[model samples]
Target: MSRHILPPKAGHPDVICAAVGWDRPLQTYYAQVCFRTDDEPDEGEALIWRGTEPGELPTPEAAIAVITPYAEIPPRLAEQLLADMTATIGEKDGRHQAEVKRRLFGSIH
Candidate 1:
């Protein structure tokens, strides 16, 4: 199962995001972001931001970072969480970047 990280708070996280994949040839990372509330559990996990148009991040942290400021979590908490999540996810999979790409993009090769 895909790992999902929630904010270090009660109930559900105010924000959710993930590194979907990487376009190695383009040196770009693909990700998605969303906002969640008690009434909108489905809305929060949906893709509010996606890396398709350009000027997006090439790393999961960066992708998550882009949304941190807007998230309900405190800035410091959000940053720490983003860093921890990035590292944890990376460490969990040796080829985290490639695996993310493959999982999200689907057989880019």
Candidate 2:
């Protein structure tokens, strides 16, 4: 799926980046953001954010990823998706964080 990672602008149509997110088994969604740096031929590997929502990730450094179906997503759908994902994947327990991180990093970005 093609996802647009938009700049944090209230009313901007053009997008500067793109992203892709997938649901993991450990009750988390890993999102990847990719963009062209310096607006040249060189492209850099962007950040991968593990979050459930937009406001849930208030900090930009923490990852404000814009993934598919989320470019124009609403708060209600985001909550529902997160709930369903959590219900399916269960909880975020230890002994799995490392595995999850490894898997997410490998698959995302």
Candidate 3:
């Protein structure tokens, strides 16, 4: 079964944006923050992240690990973003894909 914790009309998230970002690759969106206009073309899926308590991040490593769940990409995207990943995202040149990801990131929040 699926799970959603955000409550509507309570200042909670309303939709999830699951996409294969070029930069982040696959950001698994779990927040309910989408619109009907957005639902049709993209076929959005919610993303979920994992992070330690907000207050537990006092050091650099801790800070990096904490509050990370909020902006995690989907597994597919993450795999591509991996530094050592030598996989082919598409048959075309990989540089184009990187450019697309950069532009998408710049255009959105």
Of the candidates shown, which would achieve the greatest lDDT relative to the real structure?
A: 1
lDDT of candidate 3 over 1-109, digit per residue (tens) = 0122322232333333322211123222122333224445354343333222222222323322322333343333333333212332333425765576467554221
**Clash tally, candidates in order:** 4, 0, 17
Report the C-alpha displacement of residue 58, candidate 2, in angstroms: 14
Q: TM-score of the candidate numbered 2?
A: 0.33
lDDT of 2 by residue, 9-75 (tens): 3332233444433244333344554444555334544543455532343322223244542244344
Off by over 4 Å in 2: 1-15, 18-22, 38-44, 51-73, 83-109
Using all chains and alpha carbons, the TM-scores for the candidates as numbered come to 0.32, 0.33, 0.21
TM-score attained by model 1: 0.32
Candidate with better TM-score, 2 vs 3: 2
Estimate the lDDT of model 2: 0.41
Q: Residue by residue across 34-109, what tens digits does model 1's lDDT show?
A: 5665667765655455556333654556655554454333445435434543543433333665576577766323
What range of 10 consecutive residues in model 3 has the weakest lDDT sum?
18-27
The models' CA-based lDDT, in order, is 0.46, 0.41, 0.31
How much lDDT does candidate 1 score? Answer: 0.46
Candidate 1 weakest ten by summed lDDT = 1-10
